[model samples]
Target chain A: MPDTAPPAPSGLAGPPVNLRNPVLAGVLAFLIPGLGHWYQGRRFKAVLYAVCILGCFFGGLSIGHGQVVYFHWQNPENRTYAYLCQFWTGLPALPALWQAKYRDPAVFEDNRLDRELNAVLTATLRGVEGELRGSIQIPPGNPGFGRGFSAPFEGQLRTPSGSVPVKGQLSALMLDPQVGAGSRRRIRGYFDGAPTSDNSGPLVGPIEGSVPRPLWDWYGAPLADTDGSPNSQLNQAHRALGSRFELGVVYTMIAGLLNVLAIFDALYGPAYGDEEVGPLGPTPGPNPTPGSPPSPGTAPATSTPVSPGGSA
Target chain B: MFPATLLFPLLAAPVWAWAGPTRTWYAIPLIISISLVYSASRHEGPPLILRRALRLMLTIGGFMLALLLLLLLLSRGT
Candidate 1:
């Protein structure tokens, strides 16, 4: 594309356009879609980029319940590559980085009352599986929360063959599967709900239940599975969003990518540089062999350029 | 329905709130934004950008529908 075009047709210069600072304009456009264009007295591109890019970015977040964009560089297990594209959205997607940094695994809620029967017991549980019935008895006021809760539980631990009645004092504490400023926690630790069940000794297993997930922990967070496996995290996220996950990811990535074009436009006029291409695009050159360059008669962007003060 | 939400989340109230309808409906806004932005990048005149963007949008929508139909036909008996 030629840098300069023929002089603009008379009476074309409407307002002053200042694209003198290419580096600054590029950087500013990168920081916020259309900002550099606005600074350069290009309101049309400014509003266009701001509306399209910001709309796409936030729209994606809402679709995925704000889980589509995050930053997780450490622990190669669950590194979030989507963040690279999302970073181009600027401030709207920046909080995830800060939230990820200060995330404390030790912080957890102590309310697991969903599974406790009227049997008056401590430590409620979520995600009650089949045949695992009966009340769990623990110390008053959610026992061993952050440091891991352990207590004896009495219930029928479901086995492959049948329900085995086993009751014993559980040693390891089991918290909910949700952490980070929540009322419950992730399902960790083991509990012997029963002992000597189907002719075996002590029924030991992970606490079972669906703990209510927290907003912060789920929003734009690279949450891993309880076993510290990265493989299932993405699956879990996809399950949560249903088929909308891919759409949300694409929307956000496209938003960032569109801003890249806006940034270039700000750094150096419009991409076509004052060409006279019609809706069908530049005049067609001779139909040449597949990879041949365009003939000079129908060059793409060699038309008259709008002066610095010309309206775009 | 995500389809309704996709079109107008604040309105439309969803005829099937429980069952999110077709995901393909997202192509409407996606194509619109993409075409407009791409066209704006290539032209200084708003009228020119809108004209090019409309053409591009129609072309993309038609191409996508053709692809979808082809895929359905190819997998008809499967």
Candidate 2:
């Protein structure tokens, strides 16, 4: 050990490194795993830390179809506690915070059309409305809930009693999409078809249908309806992944948490009293490995108590 | 630029198609990561970190397997 230990902010790594700035390394690591180590000239540690942390983070994202990391702190039903851990992954998870603040995801599953029906003047159809034995065809266009074709329709309307041939005109108007609680837009139209009477319209009651919500409204947004809101994206996320949603959350969370250790490693040298391997390595004492044998004196410098701050 | 979700609306669906029953296997990467990071915290050199990480990985994997076996034995035929 040199009888003198010169100190500067950048020379914090003792067993002595020239420019291993610890504070900057910590901040960089917090922003992106391994960045601090990279800044500290620990290239190998940097690569491994980045690989491990980012792999887990992105892997969880892929598992959940990129729906896992979202921040909703104020919403009682959507308070994302896992985000406390997920936040440590740094930049990748930061977007969730932006989304929570700026994006609304203002759409929900309502009378959205499962499929588009083309305009038809008189089309044959079978199994009309499940119980109806005959087919029904209405006008061509995307119909919302409670709305059907304004044009004439021809099909057998099946009843519990028996199959009955029915002919009528379907008329309905689109309802204004007033989102529930001002949070989500529900698109729907109501229509009651005229049955039997060509001039009068449907014999049956009204039906409601809707156009599907845009995908952008739900992706990466918090979806769980834990707040008793029926219009959450959680339903869709749950439908797609089933139980894997939680697993994805766990994976990303662990990755975030793991980066914390890397941050600490960057701020302070090895947690155990292991000497940093470098040209100015001090004599092995103070903290010795339990099983490893001490090295013979190829060379040894005078000893001084090591501080994490590299203070002598 | 438009978000990818808007471009590929259907991407909401899970694309990996991992087997539903075998999610337990997904822990391998997590365990390895945990081992590597934890070991790195305790050692300064890359060689020391790698060697320590390998032992930690084995230890964690063994513990999980033993726990799984215990649960399997306890829950048999239930």
- lDDT (CA) for every model shown? 0.59, 0.59
Query: What tens digits encode model 1's per-residue C-alpha lDDT throughout A1-312?
Result: 232333222111111234656567678888888888777667887898899899999888777666677777776765778788888877677766766777664432334433432231233233433444445444544454455545555666564666665566545555433333222234445555444534544345554442345466555555544456444555666777787887888889888888777876766555453445556655332222344332221223333332333322
DockQ of each: 0.32, 0.34
What docking grade does candidate 1 earn? acceptable
Alpha-carbon deviation at B39 in model 1, angstroms: 1.2
The segments of candidate 2 whose C-alpha lies over 4 angstroms from its true place after superposition are: A1-14, A17-19, A104-219, A224-231, A273-312, B1-21
TM-score between candidate 2 and the true structure: 0.57
Q: In model 2, how large is the Cα lDDT of residue A136?
A: 30
Question: On a 0 to 100 scale, what is the lDDT of residue A159 in model 1?
Answer: 44
